[model samples]
Target: MPAAVPLADNAVRHADGQGHAARFDAQSTCAVIVTHGPDPALLQQVVASVVPQVGHVVVFDNGSGGVDVAGLLAGHRRVSVMPSALNVGLGAALNRACERARELGFLHVLMMDQDSVLAEGMVHTLGAALVELQQGGDVAAVGPQFRDARSGELAPFVRFGFPFNRKLRGGPGQRVSCDFLITSGSLVPVESLVRIGPMDEALFIDNIDMDWCFRAKRAGLSLHGICDAQMAHSIGEQLLASRVKQDGVIVHKPFRLYFIMRNRVLLYRRGYTPRVWIAQDVPRLVLKFIGNALFLPARWQRLVFMCKGLRDGVAGRSGGLPG
Candidate 1:
């Protein structure tokens, strides 16, 4: 056989030192859900829900607060646990998992967050949409509708439009051609991932998915929403909040405000044009900074984060948020 081509510069080589061929046949698919020291019950529920639908489950553990996730998954025949010694940020951890999944020969990899629970038949729904896209011949990635767990209502997937400051909202059950923003419950094709390369690890946590989706779009792949498939997510739970109910219960968490203010500017500078930044984003960011400074505690930290994001953007730094 002819020598295999390297999928990426950092791609692992087979025993003979050439890149290995992909493992999955045309019909088979693999799903990987990333977790970091999540509640064991939630992990079990996530695994139980997903294992039945996919060919295999690879649980990417990013330093789970000393949780024995591997032990929990030990007896399962189809589940494999890969542990990281420390928290390497979401983008890096997911990229590492994608590499392993690619090597295992899975055609499609579903990138899932720990707090989100897959609704019944969610996997099949996404998979069917992917197949439809593939048959249509131009689809690159597919993401499902994300619903708030408490209210049972759909949430908006943030779409950062050009000219930086403007964002177009994608509603639940709406099928649209997106400009590189998908939420936690998204499915990525292994071939496209290899072609586009791993996500920017420097992003560490926020906006990494959007950055990757943008890159995929730039690489000529189409991104779509599978309107039927839905995943219930506990939004703002990781950050502490006093809960209140609207359409669903709203958690008023302070950390989310900080991250949002800091990362939104960073994303615009790195992914969008400067004109967009100056026209749309800067004023909004300034208003946010002022509001946070006046009302939120740890005002200095929020301001510092905003300044750092601006500086980084001006310096042409794209991947990773400030440490």
Candidate 2:
């Protein structure tokens, strides 16, 4: 395992003080937003949206553009900033934040992406849903329905039921029990973290959320999607289009293709089972490789990524995102 690094010097200072000021209460939840490189304006908007409701807001900057994120958040009485000088990838950064949250006595952690904005009362809505789930005594984590910021339409939250073979889609305003995988807009209880542990930093960037969910399920925790709470996520059109177009293309950009292929196989090896892998993962990967080869600009890199992903998955290598 790579040596565990603290976020950034400034982040540590900010969090250290604020951690003492806003200790967690059982009645309140703390939110942690993870960012790599986010537009300053967008980050501010995200802070403004959640600061009022959550007990505290911690911004985990993963090797951002050296912007003064700590300065930006300094004024807010409830906000603290943590920066990672090296881009340690999202999973590791979040785990660090979760660890901090635990130390601060927070009972729940809300994971947010820097570009996302919660809908009006969305935090309260998710909080309510989580309370309901806890009362029911079965759910491990719960995520809200996500809406596309650009399109203004609800995006389906995909759920895979037991036997892990079939995927069920839950539309907007429809509640569904799931083996919770999606994380961009979700709230997780600290208890779940204590039980299943933080996301696998080994898987690093891709499918880390799903990998966590699968582990939680195996440990006898249930995951669910709460339909009422919603957030608008900026899934940039250009990146989306490229990803869809190159689903199977053997393109160049080895780093991009490498994680896509590697994480898929890693998920399977971890516990996804062969039937599930064949029915879902394989077809998606093959087509992705083909799509990249046919349409993407970096065909050779893409193919190399696919090959490496296959090799790592088969070899059962685990720990951190590929460098």
Candidate 3:
């Protein structure tokens, strides 16, 4: 086994071939990978893609359930693994990564999910955009466009709406402003992150990005998506195409709906969610509930869990899933 360089605050270091150590501080940027029960093979691929682009890489495992993350990343000199004993949820894990990044002196953090594979030059592209945007605006963060791994279709950036949400579409190599950007593949400045505050761990899993984007907008910061900077990612376990509708539907596991419904309700209750989104999303949620109840194999279980999620959200309950 190669030697591991121990750093302050529970960080392990690996040395690049040039004997250049990771220089994490106020002047440098680091990549933080927050993962759950991810495929070790895919996670290793993701780490390899990022290690060459950023100053260093930190993997925060949110209960990966016995995957030897340290072993998977064993030989990489630029990577460190922080494994959790149980699922702590995405927001909390990312926050922990951010805390560690700050402690190690990283001024910016590029956040990504374990399965997200970056295109070549993605970090450099986003970093360049961040520098350019910050010169004239309060750029909270810049994110890459997501290309679905299975379908090869690009997901458009979102825009705020009432009754009708809009997609911000751009041609190749274009940059555009957007209302929301998923946490995965987002490059955020530490100073702006501090001002916007840590992610709402209360939501636990779902809709955390939207909540943070709304907060950033309220704080007069702009979020942008670089059209050419792409990430190969998947939104759900399965994607079902609507035979007649233009849009496709992503199918998550039954229990996953709990976090989705609960988080949206909580966001609305806290007044962080826009009235427009609430006006439109509530009806959409109802439609989703109906569709899942009718089509999903685990119909009753999903509906029951969703209803319980709604109740918990109304009751202002948050954190990891309840037993």
Model 3: residues >4 Å from true position, as ranges? 1-27, 244-247
Q: How well does each candidate superpose onto the true structure, as a TM-score? A: 0.75, 0.81, 0.91
What is the alpha-carbon lDDT for the whole of candidate 2? 0.68
Model 1 lDDT per residue over 162-212, tens place: 554223335545565565545467777777787777877766676677667
Q: What does candidate 3's lDDT look like per residue over 1-323, in tens digits? A: 33222234333333334332233232266789998878988998898888877777888988888787878788898677788998888899999988887776766789999899999988878877776666666788999998888777888988878777788769787888988899999999888889999998878898998999999998999999999898899887887788855547888999999998888888888665678888889998898889888888899999998998999999999988899
What is the model-wide C-alpha lDDT for candidate 1? 0.64
Worst 10 contiguous positions by lDDT, candidate 2: 1-10
Over the stretch 185-299, how does candidate 2's per-residue lDDT look in tens digits? 6778776787788888877777778778777877887777777877777553233324443321123344756666777777776544334434665776787778776666667
- The order of the candidates by TM-score, greatest first, is 3, 2, 1
Instruction: Kindly state the number of residue pairs that clash in model 3.
Output: 2
lDDT of each: 0.64, 0.68, 0.82
- Collision count for each candidate, in order: 9, 21, 2
Instruction: Point out where model 2 deviates above 4 Å.
Output: 1-27, 161-173, 235-254, 272-278, 319-323
Cα RMSD, each candidate:
7.5, 7.6, 5.6
